[model samples]
Target chain A: MELLANLALGLETAVTPTNLLFCFAGVFLGTFVGVIPGVGPLAAISMLFPITFYLDPTAALIMLAGIYYGTTYGGSTASILLNIPGATSSAVTCLDGHPMAKQGRAGVALFMTTIASFVGGSFGIIILSLFSPLIAEYALTFGPAEYFALMVLGLIAASTISNASPSKGLAMVVFGMLFATVGTDSQSGVGRFTFGSMSLLEGFGISAMAMGLFGVGEILSSVGATRIAKIDSSSAKLLNMLPSKDDWRRSWLPGLRGSSIGSFIGALPGTGPSIAVFMAYAFEKRVSKTPERFGHGAIEGVVAPETANNAADQTAFIPTLTLGIPGSATMALMLGALMIHGIQPGPTLIVEQPSLFWGLVMSFWIGNLLLLILNLPLIGLWVRLLLIPYHYLYPAILVFLCIGAYSVRANPADVLIILGFGFVGYAMRLADLPAAPLLLGFVLGPLVETQFRRAMVLARGDFTDVVTRPIAGTVLALAAAILVWTLVSAIMRYRRGMKALTRNPTG
Target chain B: MLDRDYRDIVAGLGLTAIGAAAALYALFNYNLGTFTRMGPGMMPVSLGIILAVFGLLIAFPALSRSGDLPPLKIRPMIVMSISIFSFALMIESVGLVPAVFFTTVIATFSETRVPLVSALVLGAGMTLLTWSLFILGLGLPISSFDWPF
Candidate 1:
């Protein structure tokens, strides 16, 4: 009865013409950007960030939420149509989606993906509405110790999953933490690393850093490499948009499994859809009847990843909303957006602003439905969109990125910071360092510091009490275990490589 | 050429310098209070030390092994950087129109350029669109031409 009442409130807010219009605009722009190979939802969100400042917080969040899920479906479009995955989470789709496209099943892949994505997203939203309230209620019992430990676990997990090696990712995370400390320390009211620059007083602007790192950094990385893929637009006729009976039989079960995997992983801090899609693909491959048919135009391969990624994108909001701990960098961006509107996103948010929470939830359902309608009949339109060349596309991006960065405070310094980080991000990519961990670390740094300090005060300076507390101790233990495990694996790999070198000295 | 790469070594050294600078600044300028009443400097100081250690670990292995170094495309990097930095320079003093026009011109060199006539048209189109979006639609506090400077 309470669920129904809450949902009714949500619909009441969501069905307003303002929310509906922004939601459509968000998803439409998300798909357009997502279909472009180098641009992503991250870039699109930041580009649109300044515009959201002019909106009511509820509409702002509803639109951003729409963009997030819209990008997921759009990424699949690029993967299937052009064999060019827009984001890393969509990379696995290209393995089978491209092959399926080659087999002239582009329309069918689009059909299955839209249906599966809707199911996966709705599955996540249902779980989110059902579980987030309970999680928030339970999290109300947490103290500074528990929060601190959870942040540690989250940071480590985020860092480790970022790159092939743990140490490099850790280095980047630490660098981000250092950068986060650049402004005046909130606790002491003393600037640590501002170096007497007036513009450095507020540290880095979140939108500015995001745009520079993902938006401009991506452009820098992709400029040198030319993409060569062709899509036969003639193949996407209306008749081919129906899945065969065999395809349907194979898709439903995998979609269910993928949604479950995505929800579980997405609920966990620091892990996101990239890991979920990979795990889903690996699990489906392992459990398949014939593993040999896995990568070569398998319908299951396309279904599992698309379903998992969409589901994961939705469930990732669970941690961010309930605990104020973001599950991914994108969630961290949303958290920053919320803070900008004076809506703190911890446990109290649900009780304090039930309308905001429920309204956002309702917007997701309405937005997902809009996406399904948009994606199906408009498959041909998205294919035509691929004809816009990079030359025309990138200049528009540069102009918008500049405006987005400048409009943060209408300060020119923000643009300078964007330029600086754009270079930093490009350099990190060249050095094979994972960039996501840095964003997560930057977001979590101040929060972790405050929690740690508070926990110390509570413990009366006895650090031993931190280890004695059961929940905090367990969370910290888990973080330590992951750290030790990665270190051990790295050492083992090093030794094996050495052994191989010694055995084949001449070679 | 061994299996391991020296790319990590360079990255680590750069990180170590940054960490050391941060730690040294904090150690000198801020009070490191006891754990009971931790000062603001405690977090950055600790993070700096951790960064140095991770940097060492990352850089150490690379010292013993050789790795292939791909030629960095210095051209695109410089071109994009200059274009962006130029806009940063002009957005406030000279205004949005000139900033957009010039930056678009420079950024175009990073890839295949359209014809000169087409490039100017594209630039004009971008200026008009930006004027509509940022100036008209969003009401950012900037002018079409702040040209007295």
Candidate 2:
């Protein structure tokens, strides 16, 4: 009954004309960006972030959340149609999605992915609505030591569980932390890395860093390499969008399983849709009767990952909203946005700002429904958007990125920081280092430092005492276990590669 | 030729240099207070040491292994950097219109195949759009055209 009443208040808040309009605009812009290969939700959100300052906090969060999930819905279009992933999370979709496109089953793939994504997203939303309040209530009992231990786990997991080498990811995370220490320290009031510059007193602007890395840096990397395969226009027509009876029968179970996997993974800190989608794809393949057809226009293959990614997208908010620990770079940016609005996200956020929290949650459902309405009939329009030459598109993106950075603080210096980070970001990409962990670290570094200091104080400077507490001990143990597992896997992989090389004896 | 992972070696060394520099600077400049009442320098120094250790961990194994370096397209990097630098220079000093126009011109040419006519057109179009969207529609405090005498 309480949940019902709370949901009613949420629906009332979400249906306001102003909030609804911004939600639509956000999803529309998200879809536009996601249909274009090489641009992701991160870039799109960063680009539009400056404008959110003018909006009411509730509306601002609703729109940003809309863009976050809307991308997952639109990203599959490019993967199926052009074999190019519109977002990093959509990369796994290209495996079977493109094959389906090749076999004139593009319409069926697109249709099923939409339905699967909706089911997955709804499941995640249900989990989010039910679990977030409970999690927040439980998290209230956490002391500074528990928070510090949990943050350590998050940072280490982010670095180790990625596609990059663990050391490179850790290096990036540490670099980000180092950068975060630049400004005047809040506790001591001493300038650490300011170098006697006034602008350095505040450290770097979040928008500048985000736009530089994900926006301008991405454009630099993708400039001469973007490829778009011709999409069959007929497949996008309404008449062709229906899946066969057999395809529908095969899709439902995998969709449900994908939703379950995605919700669990997404609820955990330091994991997101990219990992969830890949896991779902592998799981579906392993469970399939005819595994030979796994990558060859398999309906289950397309459905499972699509559903998982969308589900993961919805649930990824759990850690960010409830505990103020963002699992991914994008979630970190969302947290940054909340901080910018002077709304501190943590256990008390739900109680203090119930309307804001519930309104944003309700907006997810509206946004998902809007995506379905937009993608089905407007599928032809998005395909045509692919025809816009990269030359034309990149210039506009660069312009918007510069303006976005500038508008953040109306400071030319911030624009310069964007330029500097853009170069650094390009270098990181060249060196095969993951940038996501760095971003997560940059946002969370200051918070982690504060918690660590508090924990030490509470323990009377006895680090061992802090670790001996039950919650902190268990969480730290989990972090240590992850590190051990990563080391073992790395050694095994190296050994396997060595054996393969010895057996081949090339040349 | 030595069969070594140049990418890992170079990246590792770079990380080491940065981490060591930060640690040394913080140690010299800031106070490293006791754990109970920690100073600002405590976090940076520890994080810097961790980073340097990770760098060594990455580089040491690669000394005996072979790995390919990723392709570096220096053209786009240089071109985009220059254009953004120009935008930063002009945006506050001169105005938004000139900044957007010039940025559009330089950024578009990074493609090399963009015709001169379309580049100018895009510049004009972007200038107009930014002026309208940012200044007119949003009422941000930036002036559309501020000619510095």
Candidate 3:
């Protein structure tokens, strides 16, 4: 009964004319960027931050959140049609989705992915609505020590779990932490690392840095390398889109299982849609009665990962909204957007701003519905979009990036920050270093530092006193265990490599 | 180019130098207070040391590995930087129109295939788009055109 009332309230807030329009607009633009191969939702959202400056917080968040989930729906289109993943999370879709396309099943694959995305996304929304309030209520009991320990666990897990080389990830995290220390220290009121520059006093603008790292950096990396393969639009006929009875029968169970896995993985800190989809794909492959059908045009392959991808995308918001802790880089960027609106997200956010929280949640359903309607009829249109020449597209994108950076503070100097970080991002790419951990580090660094300081003060400078608290102790122990395991595994891998080299000198 | 892959070694050394520089600067310029009454420099110092240690860890084992450094494209980097820098310089003085046009024109050179005429058309089109979208539609405060002294 309470859930219904809350949902009723959400519907009332979401159905406002202005909110509906922006939600449509967000999903539309999301599909546009998602259909294109080079651009990701991160860059798209950052570029739109300037536009959000003029809108109300609710509308801004509604639209941005729409784009967030909407991308997962569209990303599979490219993977299935062109064998080029529109987003990193959609890469696995390319494996079987492309094969399905080759078998004159492109229409069915596209249709199934959209249906699976809706199923997964709807499931995630249900989980979010049921779980967020409970999580927030539990989080209300957290003190500074518990918060610090949890953040430490988040950072360690993020670096070690995601990256192949744990040391490199840790190094990037530390680098970002060091970078976060550059501005005037709020606690001590002392300027550190400013070098007497006025711009350095406040440190870097999150929007500007995000644009540089994600937007410009992405353009720099892909502008020269990409060659869009010509897509065959005829295979995606409207009549061919309808799935046969067998296709429907194969899809339902995987869709259900994928939603469960996606929601569970998405709620956990230090994971995202990409990881969820991969896990779902592996699980599906292993469980299949005929495993050989997997790298071929297995309909289960298309359904499971697509379902998990959208489900994970929606549920990744759980930690971000409820605990004020971002589980992934994209969530961190969204939190940064909220901060720009002068809204500090914490346990009190839902209680204090019930309309905003519920309205945004409800908008996800509308956004997903809008995507289904839009994608079904507009398949031909998006394929045509892929045909646009690269040279013409990039310059226009560059203009938006420059203007977006400048619009953040109306400061031209911010544009230069994008330029600087563009180079840094490009360099990191060259060195094969992951930029996600760096971003997570930068955003969470200050928060972790503040919590640690407060915890220390409360414990009268005794580290053990702070760590020995039941919740903090358990969380910190988890962090330490992850670190030790990562180190041990890295050593074992190194020794195995050495033994391999010894066994075969020049084989 | 060296025969062996120095990618890890170079990257590790770069991180080590940056971390060392930050740590040394923090140590020299700021006070390191006690744990409870922590100073501003304390976090920086500790983070710097940790980064340096991580860097060494990355570099040491990489000594036995063989790989080649990935090629860095200079053309896109240089062109993109120049165009953005020009926009930054022009936007405040002349305003959004000229800044967009100027940046677009220069950015077009980043790709060898684009002809000169298309750059101008794109510049004009983009300027109008930004003008209508940002200034007219959104009511952003920036003027479409301006002249400063």
Q: Which structure among the candidates has the greatest TM-score?
A: 3
The order by descending lDDT is 3, 2, 1
lDDT by residue for model 2 over A323-363, one digit each (tens)? 99988888899999989988898999899989888877888
* Candidate 1 Cα errors over 4 Å, as ranges: B1-4, B145-149
Q: Write the per-residue lDDT of candidate 1 for residues A199-241, one digit (tens) a residue.
A: 7878887888888888888788777576665778877777887
- Share of real contacts kept by model 2? 0.72
> Which candidate should be chosen as best, given DockQ against the real structure?
3
Report the lDDT of model 3 for residue A340. Answer: 84
What is each candidate's DockQ, to 2 decimals?
A: 0.63, 0.66, 0.71
Q: Comparing 1 and 3 by lDDT, which wins?
A: 3
| CA shift of A26, model 3, Å | 1.0
Top candidate when judged by lDDT against the true structure: 3
Each model's lDDT comes to 0.84, 0.85, 0.85
Off by over 4 Å in 2: A226-228, A492-507
- Which segments of model 3 are wrong by more than 4 Å? A502-507, B1-3
The full ranking of all candidates by DockQ, starting with the best, is 3, 2, 1
